[model samples]
Target: MNKEGLYRDLSTVKQQIGLAKQFLESLNSVKFDRKNVLSWFKKLCGYLTDIILTILEIRSILENHVLNKKTMLLYLYQINTTLSLYINTFVAECEIGEALNEVRIFTTKKLSSCLDGIEDVLIKGISTYPENVGNFILWMDTALEKMSEIDHLKEKEKCLKAFSDAKILFEEVLSHAMSIAQVSMSEDYKIIRGSSQSVLEGLESLSNEISKENPNSAMVKLFAETCSNKLCALERKVNVAVLKICLSTFAKYTDDLENIHKFCFNTENKSKPRDLDNLVMEFDLHVDRIMQIGLFAISCSTNMATCIKIRSCLASLEALESELVPAFNAVLLDYCKQNCNLASILKNHWLNEAVLLKRLICEIIDPLAFCQIVHEENKYLVHTLSLDVKANKSKIDRSVTEQVIRNSIVLDDFLKLITYEEDNIIHIKENISFLQKIIREVKAASDVFLPQEQPELNFKVYKRCKILLNGIYSLCKNFLVENSENSFSKEESLGNEQPVVTGNGFLDHIINRGKQILQDRSILYRSNKIEAFDLRSTTLSKMNALKEKNKSIPLSKLVHLRKISFVQSPTRNQISCELQITDIVNELRNMSLTFEKC
Candidate 1:
């Protein structure tokens, strides 16, 4: 073959080598799993095939005497050495799936033999180039000299990797032990701490040994296993300690919960309003306690579902306390307006519903009362709550439906209360608070239950509610702070000020400020008339002016103003009608010079 054909073949070989290097680099990123293991092995075979083909082409090109064989061999020598190094490093680091162990073993053996054969062919062929093969011999000697150094480097890398993995395990163990120690530094826990300290000391010693010139692999393996065992022991101790703490805490609260249950429900006394109030207060306090305990339990909990459900239940209860309770209170007040009996409202609406809620609360608390039960067995708390709630969903839905149905009736009562007692500031305040509570409950329930389905409160209603509230506040402030004689003035009478006695100076100041702000008439007038012309109009005007001046120019070509420009100049002209002395002298000089020239 001619030199040109040989050069072309050599370029093809170089391209193949480049592709093979890329595939080798890609192997570095390959994650071996059951699904991709076959494909991963396939890529490996392809890379080997590329290397083999490139070596064969180079060998064939070397047979031609036309090309300068020494330089070409040097370049070709690099292809084998560099790719061989890369493939070897990748194979050393890769962890193939065990299920493909047979396939991997067979494939790896074949690949290794192929690489050896390719290297041998290249070296043997180079020895024949030009009569004196000094370059090829020298290169072969240098490569042989570096083989030991490369092996040493590989060993060091393996040792470093092993040490790193051991260090990670050590950190995990220490962190877990520290968490347990934080929970309780009792004598038993101190034993765990001591064990952890010993493990850490052993780890440091192992690291020092690994850093030695010729460390024993067997000794390193044994020490690593020992450290691993210690870590496992430390982990087991931490788990046990956490379990013990959780048990003791749950036990302590279990008795308190039972006592509360007895006081609230299983009491001998007939349920009264005062009793219900006390029960509600106790319920809130205990729920807070349960929440604290649940938080601790969740931190220790390994189960994702348990953590999620406990967090969710606590969140729901908190929402109920902040939102639903007040709504129910307002509902009670509204119901009292109709029945004219507080006792009947409490019994009819509050009693049964409170009982049902308490029942649901008990479902969560009851499981925790059995603190002796294992976590797996006791995990039925959330499940039971779900099942029970689902079973009682119709009843719960009926309760929610009943509450929703009263919206119109409650709104009617709200209108009547506001209209009937509109002049009464105290009554208006109370009614507004009640209305706000109702809206809050509705919105809260909507958020908690079915946010997508529940329609939002109309914007107009919200605005009007705010207006009514503001008007009431203004009247109160004006009556308290502004009215002279504390009697009605023109503005006060026009505002229909109520009789408000604010003994607090701070309160009077605040209210007076609020009233002034609300009644501030300057807001009706613009401070700067020029500001009324915004940047949009000014830019448009400028663009129109530019267009009229040059019809050929596009709007985009016109300069853009970042902000509106307001031009200011002297109000009175600075030029005087009565000339200055300098000006008069110059004019006289000019007149004399002109007449003389004529």
Candidate 2:
């Protein structure tokens, strides 16, 4: 025999036999010894058969290519490695049902002598181009060296994908289980758990690898795997939780089938099929993966260590699924029994049957009433405070003074309202005093209105005031700040912005014309009396152009033309409010005079 040539030929034969041996071995370990094991084994074998088909196809290509000496050596290596990969791939491919299993049966049987246990399992080979065989081999060697780092990550990817597949299977089992009895369901449940555990262990181990430095993309993959694991687990948990919530919280008793109907029949929305369809599809996928993969194996178990690890994973998954049942069911029941989130329930109700929810209309009405009361009170407070500030100003920019005061008052009020705890009785008081502080500064600012004050109004006062008002309005509209829809604006009506009111003396005119005059004297109003003491002057609404390109920005930032702060003086609102105050004041004065005459 030619020493070198013979050795090479033998090597080729050795490789071919080695690959075939692995598949046969995995086939033998197909759990056929156990009752359900054969089912799993058969499913796995289906994938293996396809894998073998793919291999034979790829192998045929080797005949067509002419190989040089170096190419031949590499090509021979490629053949065996490629074959091994086909087998391993049963657990490797995504979405598709490829990536055959890692057969560790033979290895498992000889765990005592690991080195000699099965060199076949110990070796990992891949087909490479003749030129790149050196590089491929080197890469694999290096990979093995760093295997400890990526091993977890590799396992995780495998595990996650497997779990995903198993989940699909579980759905089928769960459907059948539901139709059957509890004791019967228990056996199938174990199978689902075992499949899921195999998937999770693979993912978790990978996640732990490079979770620290984010090294190589292993961490990202690890994270993705972890998320997938978490998500899949949560998906199962969600179904369990939702069922529990439905039966107990929204429905009836422990033994009552009516409980299920409570969730199905009395839905908030009218479309039962729409809601159920969505839930069913989502849940169906979740469990199907488990059942489908539970009884399937990619290839035979040729490696003892791999088999041991895999079995351990399968056991863990089964344990989690089977053992956690009571707890999960209890959790759902508990959620339904006590922890009813009104918001969540309402949302679900709406989803279940929106039209039906209309029946509960009055339950949402009182909150609206309270909201209206708050809005009216705010309007009275805002106008009053702004007016008082203007009255107090000395010789400042009148417009500046009014605006500054209004803005300050509004901003303060918002800060108070939003931050105010219902338990805390504090708020930016909507009184004259808060406005008064703004009035003084605004008056001073008004004297300087042109370049400085005008800019100030644009930058500081007007802009700020606009924000505060808009914020309050929006908050109130959302029923976050004030309350009911009709409280601020009429619903089903195209609500209009408060119109711009032009002209001066509007304030003083109203005050003086009041039936009950606090004082009939048209006293000096402003510093030089140039500005009138009328509500109309300062209260006029303006249609300032919003200089914004992006309309989505808050209305406060875009529009600041006008405001209706109710910070008016006693005689400021004319026929509206001031007149009423005046009439009362006059009556009081006349009474005092009568006392004097007496």
**Which structure among the candidates has the greatest lDDT?**
1
Clashing pairs in 1: none
Candidate 2 per-residue C-alpha lDDT over 78-111 given as tens digits, one digit per residue, 9 for 90 to 100: 2222222222222222223222122233122222
**In model 2, which regions exceed 4 Å deviation?**
1-436, 449-458, 467-494, 497-598
Per-model lDDT: 0.36, 0.30
TM-score of every candidate relative to the true structure: 0.24, 0.14
List model 1 lDDT by residue over 348-379, tens digit each: 22233323333332222212111212221222
